[model samples]
Target chain A: MAGDGTGGGSQVVLVTGGYDHTIKLWQAHSGVCLRTMQHPDSQVNGLEISPNGQMVAACGYQHIRMYDLASANPDPVITFEGITKNVSRVGFQKNGSWMYTGGEDCTARIWDPRAPPQTRCQKIFQVQAPVNAVMLHPDQSQIMVGDQSGIIHMWDLKTDQNDQLVPEAEASIQDIAIDPAGKMMAAVNNKGNCYVWALGGQAHPVPRKHIAAHHKYALRCKFSRDSTMLVTTSGDCSAKVWRTSDWTPMRELRHETQRWVWDAAFSIDSRFLFTGSSDSYARLWDVERGTLEREYCGHQKAITALAFKDQAV
Target chain B: MEVRPPEKQKSLLAEQLENCPNLPHRQYLEYAKFDGTAQMGLPTKSFKIFMTMLPEKHQNYPLVVCVIANAKIKDLIGFTCYKYSIEHPEISLGSVHDYGLCIAEDDGEVDWAFPCLDSNEPCSKFGFTCLGLIELKYKTVCAAPIPMPEDGIAFHMFPKAADSGQSHQNTSRHNTGGSQTSEAVISAIRAVNEDKKKSGDVNLEKIQSHIMATEAPQYKVYKVYLLRKVRTNTPVQLGVSLDRIEVEPLVTHKHAFWQSRSKYFLHSIDSVAWCQVLETRGNRTTFRIIYSPSHNAAYSDKNISGNTSFFHPNSTYKVHDFECEHDMAKEIVEKVNTILDLRNSPCRREYKTAKEKKSQTRRSFHTKHLS
Candidate 1:
């Protein structure tokens, strides 16, 4: 499980299950555990926080669950279960009104977070291969889906239109992040390659730059708030920062334990970068100086997800 | 030298005078073209005459040789005089008046001075000399050198009449000295011209390319994190590892430009007086001991007031003062130093833990005993 900096009185964390079949919450700057919400029957595979930081959505074996951080544990306020196979990843709209789930069912489903329990799940689009990861565009009207075949499919919700799928990669697509300005999209493939593409053009989504981002599999990628920097975590046991201007590497963080870094996220101010690794530790880094400031090591297994919440209202 | 006959002299003079239509009869004459018209005029008080003397090879003919006059007298009087002489079959007075027209030569000899064939006394009240005479041959006037006035009762002749034999010597001298000087001047002019041509041919593009090719590429080595490791007597296998390497470009002041500005300040304090240290989130403080060899003083001199400390050869000092995890710092420094030492060592080597080394030694002893 990974903790996110929240915009509230307390920080919230979404935990994917390993030894513990639950997602937990903690205070942001202080490492005090706040809540523990258990999964019903299966391990939690993925978790995503809404841009507003009010809702946390988790996908598991056969269901996608959305939890309002303000509510108590044991049950999600809303749940969706239309996918036939285990859901691998989940994402939320920036406004917290909608949720998206990608799974082995080879389709990405969109759900209404405000709908009644009976009517929450809805099928949006189908892909050829199992969708491994999904991310909602910052605009909240479109969703980008990465599949097992490494192709990325963009679904426009408003017009019910599917953009042409981008091909030309050789591995599974693991993670995707859209720049804050919505001008570029960065995608990391399972083979450790990262490609940045330009947005809004008659020209095909040509990769603006390509980097052999990691020595091994790159599991996750995220852009900073100002969109000037990118942070990535890899199976190579390291995290890296890249400058967006020239796609040049800024720094690499390596650990002596050689833990598999599963996910990385930046704070809203982008002063801190947090990486969750297989060593059951979540380390906070001073991004500018590339120094590890603190390490939270409470989890028993790998921490597969991480996020930062803004201050609470 | 034999004198040329008078008949021949008259013919030469006639030839020399044939085309000269504006020869002034009484004062120095000058001709200049202005607005496409030749203006033959005379200066005041001064007089000029053109004369041609016949050579011995053509004594049967006479020609004019030279022109002479006092230019300063002409300027004073504002007009010049011109005169010509011609042989006539008449005698006027005494033996002096029996000769053809004569004028005194300016050479100041009395015997060669002759009275005018028409008037008995000196030709003019001002004692002016006839400028020269003309000699002719086949319609062309040839100049001959005039004789010295000491030759008694001599007729006025051109000055070049006496200089013809020496012309070959003058031409050879002129060729040697004048040509050498002219050649040197010409070569200097050529060198300057060639330099200008080469300067124009310089390719600025190629020069820029060469500069870029030869110039060293700049590198920025940021102090990402200082790893500190401190090992007790425990013989721990210390190794340092860098996790994230981030590089940010830092623009440093050019050494020459900074040094030039440094000259304006009397002391180091005054040099940085106007500059303030900026406090940024990750700003780092650096400490160095600066010593001036010329001043024979260290940065810790009493006159300099700051936190700066001087470094001495045999002295140890605690340099850095910052708060960090003590264990992590000690481990990092030790590991970094171990790596540095390994890299600096001449022999390529690796370290084995004490346990591993002990086990290996025991195994080797056992094998030797078995053998």
Candidate 2:
């Protein structure tokens, strides 16, 4: 389970299914299992939290689902299942009312939670190759979709328009983030370089800094709640913390198992970092001292997805 | 008196001195012969006075022995004669040993002017003229003066003559010498003194200027603005300025016989909303504002107030409008201006207001400025 850095007022825990095909939720700090939900047919690949933290979205093989925490026994209240292959990543609107999902089918679809099921599964974007990652703007007005071709395309959700494709990396773009301030965005590539782009004022996204964020293929990249720090995990089995100042590496935590660290998240207070690795375990570390604080073990196979909820339920 | 041969002139001058009485004749003869080269011609009256005053040894060796006794004497006499002649150029002389001992005892007037060998100008100095004539005559009569090995006459006498004051001045006029002038020496001393004075004054001025320009206490200002969506009664106005705001131009669509103009505004606001402001001016204005996100409520309130304003808890009315003249303009300009004004005000005056002091301490930590 992954918890956000928004603090103890409300905390969100997101867990993805491994080979078991069952996704579970537990208290972020206490490790108490809250609920367990089953996916349809395939294992869960990715999970995400909307900016408002009111809803949790999950993607599995060929299916996309969103669960509203406000409801009891909240099953997949909204389901999109037209993809030819398993879904890889998913993102939600800032308001938590809509979500976009990408999959191995080489297409990205936008879903409206308010729309009836018959009209909800809408294909908003399609690519030549399978989509691997997706990120939504903090304002919920634009969506950035990345595919296997290493190309990132920005789509204006409000205008129903597609912007010019941004050449992000020579290799596949694995993960992307728009900072809390919405002033900057960071994208990690398969080659381990994190490219940051400044938004607004300019007609196109301009690269602000290129950071050698990881030693091996970077699996996930995320910004802190305050946007002062960036955390990234890599196949090199280490998680690194980078300060925006000079884009210098500030801290690093290496796991003894040497498994590919698939994803990482910062706690709401920015005091702790959690990593989900291929070893089927999630480890929590002190952000400042780089000390391992706790480890949670339960997933039957490689832990592929992680997301954090700041508000406590 | 008898005329002496050119070579025997020294002996002849000594012999004639034997009959001198007024002065020591042998002494006179010794003085003249010691000079080595004797000139012809002796005055008779001066020679008689010289014989009567002769001492016993001078009387016995008046002629031949006098030459030997006075060998060293000539050098002393030559030096004195050279000095006097150069200083008093009006005196003149014909030759050494002329007028014999009579010339030594009786102070006879001598015209010292002698023609210079190089310029053919008459040299009137008694001593310098005699020396010059001796040098010229020696060069003609002999190979040259056989300078002493211990003290070379060429190194001492000839070089000294070439380096004399007049010779130096003449070389300087032609710009051929390196000797410095008195005026150059004086100016160099003055320049060194002036430089010392200037450096002392410059250092003092620099210190005074630094003290005068010492930095005053400084502060930062953060401006917060509010934005709301249209239509809902419960407008949720977030107390933060939009990161980027753009107002689109009004566009008219013509369909059939009807035309409608629509103006749309776009604002992008981030999650965080805080700005830093100086302590002084922050007290005069409210720090926070409440806004209802519903467009209908905001429009109705804006219409009633006849201005764009946000809700402030402390104000009498629900709405607080900034003193801006433009009705349609956004609150960004007002918020930014307030922040600038607050930051520019003095820190001490700002402390007098309780509200300003509280907000100032809340935003930033007060610490000494470091350079």
Candidate 3:
């Protein structure tokens, strides 16, 4: 009876935003909007929580703003305004020493979070086209940069050597994900195709499986925290979870009215999942039962980006 | 009894979770492979190091450190630290205890003595025995600590005779046998070569890789200078501001790569301007050009007009600085462009939503050449 509450009764921090131009912090158990912060400038493109859970970063058109999670300050404490074009991804290093971001500017950048406003970006990895997604591998040494050009660049932070691979020709790489075990990698393209690779200690990742996840454009693909499941959301108005043991379909979460699913985040235990959709509501679904557990209903516009940092393992 | 089709057996829940909600291997042991590797000369005097979770109050995240006996203990040889994410635990952590190489002293023992005055109480009071110090052999990814120690203690290295084929073949083999010894040797040599050289540094010439022997210069953090031209009635007077950005790049690519390019050069004229080397007389460097007159046209063609609010034709300045700080300058330019972009592409009805833009991009993606 101790774990009877919603979201497995874990202490979770959930932040969601989108076209509403507002970011709402939610209480995971009750689905209540604990606080609302006005973005005001532009629709949030991507959101992330710092490794320490003290700050929440939201990336929009040409700007990355960091809100204080420990306090009730509505205004952003640290604002990165100078990034040109739309920033599609924002993430922090495991130790919180630096942050990494990718944007439509055709580059992935590393920035020191403690530095002053003028001097933040410390390193830059240039790609051929506008980058769609940027991810840090669990090994913490390599950064996965996925661009609209369909090329995924594996940049080694220790050696600064970059290796590139093209999964499909003319297919824009929308998102890239490496499992927590560092054993598998998944990349979803705009063509609604998902490519999986079994990674080794070597530089290149070998192609494992190709899943036609969605009929329409695929928006995002993420691996569960346990590395047991892979969830892919698409414009086809459904989110499909695949078992990692075998590339077999486990469940397809769909709603009649949901137009497009933009983003998804898994709970700490990997038993629950939270997804933000174009319907202007973020819903939590039980992964095992494939059922809707709670609905966070406050945003007036589409929920495009969300960041959830659940209880530490 | 009729057998179910292979497809029909695919259930709603995962195969392992369908019958029993709790997984059988909730906390499974990720074994280390010592196969193929001859344990002939492997050090046998290992200890039971206690690792306890560091409190949330003392640290930002939960980090467990192995507590080893001090250098004074005769039985103490050397120890390694292993870390895995508590949330997303790896199924099989190939190697349990392996980090940088520890060169042995004259007594045939590698002494690892790190300062533990502050760590003593935390380990004894709250730490638990998470892992044991054992000889492991496997192919695994290892993490290199950032901001490495400035000076490391140098010990007399163990002779290479112990790793010879003759010695490994004579030893009794265990079940944990595999082709893993060569990898450990490779990593140990890498650690030795990666050691920074100092006055008292012990030369690891025998174990060093030939590639590392070429001596690539280590990366260094440099101070940036913001040079601006002043027009105070007289000719353009040079003004150097010391409160500039901080950049850390390898010495080889020091002056050419700036992580932030917008802060120092205009995107349109960046190619033409950076090619020209300004006068560098006695540390007094002339300004290149960091700020451009307007946002690039590639960005303006999306939805709205150019960002005319922040850009003025006459306000562009020349920036002359190191390439390390050039990226920082690009960040500044990006910030300026964002402010200007807000003026033209505000959060209004005229601007398209993300969904619309995504759809448009998808339509145009087919015609676009892949990079």
Candidate 4:
């Protein structure tokens, strides 16, 4: 993606990783594959670009690797090790002073990237089951963690306190997303239901509503930068966009060969959507017209995870 | 049975129409009257209304129009679309099984017709009945109600000759001779009433049996955007009847008014190498058919002249893509495959399941107005 602050002037940096154990960088507008970095040890479970857009942190089994985005190097500059199982998700704090990750090790950990490798672990929030997803509120004061047992643990950074709730009885939580405004939060589960929460300054986050977004397993949910649209991808080979006003479906992004859309991201403007599918292709679609604008080919296997940074730094 | 609009009093809409009386047929077809016979067009008001139903920006872009109709249900219905200011008559299709409308004859002969809305005017080529089961979007309810029949209804189109007195005489004679053969039982197709039994609903099963009774070939023409062109309009029509294959691009110039000429390729069932329907992320499904042209003698009578670039007529095979609702891709695939089976050509390359959307029908749109 041309907007990744990486190509020097806040150009997009689109990187996709999957079971194929390779990460690919793409020129978002032209559908061109820019670079391919190999993850020979294990498949990349998740990918996140630094807030500065100068580095991409890839989540893998027992390790998290950080690669330089400003240079052409294909090797990882730093590998955060000492994790016991598959690192399910990875993300950076707003200022890049620290990073947060959730893993099958049944814990969500905060790491200070500037610390020595042995003492990089800053704090850990342990749960009964594996953590599948974690999202930081835009205020950067709290982290929302979703686990395999359907429990969501809200960890407050400033107070060092935690609160937990179960949105469903048995359905595993797949992903969680907080809207850019920090006023609402959305979480998806294996049952294809999405639960939203209205966040208040000091009060408990109130349950807003639950949407039956898909008939099959829901994989991911993302809120647009403007906080007006919510997009959900599912194993049903579809990604649906919903208007935030009344939660009515806006458009469905689909291509004939596209199957099991695993990850999707809204461009900085929210007028275009980029999706990675199980068919080894990533596509750019016009959000308003619901038409395909471009297709990025060349992945050897399904692209299960993608990180896109298009904002100008 | 007599079924009419209950207590029909002309509404304000009728009075508005009366103030602007329709243009006479002679004045409407005047531009090309000297160049042999003229094609019948829609009344100016109806044409404007029809154009308004289409997308405003792409009004002049290439379009694929398809219609289906039956002869027994005779309310005069047809289409008129403009081509750079030169208006042209539209094609209406009919038939369920074989008899009502067939693209090719029982013997494999291809005779395409460009039908008209006016029953008095002679149609192009030889006379032919229209195919049944077309959407009634542009149907004009002004023509005299059709008097029903015994065996089946007769939707006859007069064809050939100039604006000579003899052509008119031949048409009325054909119309009367055609209607007299069947019993004079009136089965009206339009103007329904509150009484269910009194209102004439054109039974679909009966039309099916009527068509199957003839064992004839039937076809349909669809209006769509083909070849990504922005100017010339096209209608790719194909019909299935017997074990035969044919391809002809029929070009009919309604107004012989334009200085430049265009070529229209009519793709028959035989010319199609494959049929595919791939449902995209959206609610609509897309129909894709590969048309490979053959330089055979049967296609010579089709419309062709200058500016072949519109469709790239010289290309080996061109792909025509159009968005159709209602499981159209599956229907087209099955129909095309039946003929391909006869030819022993292996074509279906993708999983019909992968390409087809799970749902056969389009989902309803929830717009702001509905919300």
Write model 2 residue lDDT over A1-313, tens digit each, in one string: 1111121123345454455455555445423234445554776778887667666677887778776554333245556655678888887765666678877888778888666556776656877777888887776677888777888878776677787555454588888887766777888888898888887667578889888787689888888766778988899888889897678888888866749888787766566677887776666666777766545444545777777664321
Clashes of each: 73, 48, 32, 37
lDDT, model 4, position B156: 36
If you score just chain A, what TM-score does every candidate get? 0.89, 0.88, 0.95, 0.95
Q: What is the C-alpha lDDT of each candidate?
A: 0.47, 0.47, 0.54, 0.56
Question: Which DockQ values do the candidates obtain, in the order shown?
Answer: 0.00, 0.00, 0.02, 0.01
Overall local distance difference test of candidate 3: 0.54
lDDT per residue as tens, model 4, A1-313: 1111223222467888887677887655434355556576788888999988888999989989988877654556677889989998898987898999999999999998877667889999998999999998777888899999999999988998999878899999999998877878899999999998888664688888889999999999999877788999999999999988888899988777889988988777677778999987777676887866556655656889898876431
Q: Give fnat for candidate 2.
A: 0.00
Give the alpha carbon lDDT tens digit for every residue of B1-371 in model 1.
12121121122111211212111110111110000000011111222222222233222221111111222322211111111111110100111111133342432122223432232232233444333332112112212333423322233321211211221121211121111112222332344335335445326754443333212111112232221244221111111121111112122345544432211111121011011122223334311111121222322243332223345332122222221234433323333332222121111011112233567569657856775
lDDT of 4: 0.56
Report lDDT (Cα) of residue B65, candidate 4.
19
Model 2: per-residue Cα lDDT over B184-284, one tens digit each: 22232344334336445336654543222121011112222222234222112222221222223222244523432122222221111222222223223
lDDT of 3 at B287: 29
Regions more than 4 Å wrong, model 3:
A1-10, B1-371
The lDDT leader among the candidates is: 4
DockQ, Cα level, model 3: 0.02
TM-score of each: 0.43, 0.43, 0.46, 0.46
TM-score, model 1, chain B versus true chain B: 0.13
Range of the 10 consecutive residues with the lowest summed lDDT in candidate 1 chain B: B31-40
lDDT of 3 by residue, B1-371 (tens): 12121121222122111222211111111110110010111111112222211111222212212222221121121212212211112211122222222222222222234212222232233222222221212112213212212221221111222332321121211111221223333333333224313222335642242212111111122344433345222111121111112222222345656533323222322111121234545544332433332333333232132224244553243333432234433433333232222121212111223334556467546435341
Best DockQ among the predictions, by candidate number: 3
Q: What is the lDDT of candidate 1?
A: 0.47
Q: Give the poorly placed runs of model 2, Cα more than 4 Å off.
A: A1-16, A50-54, A68-75, A165-169, B1-371
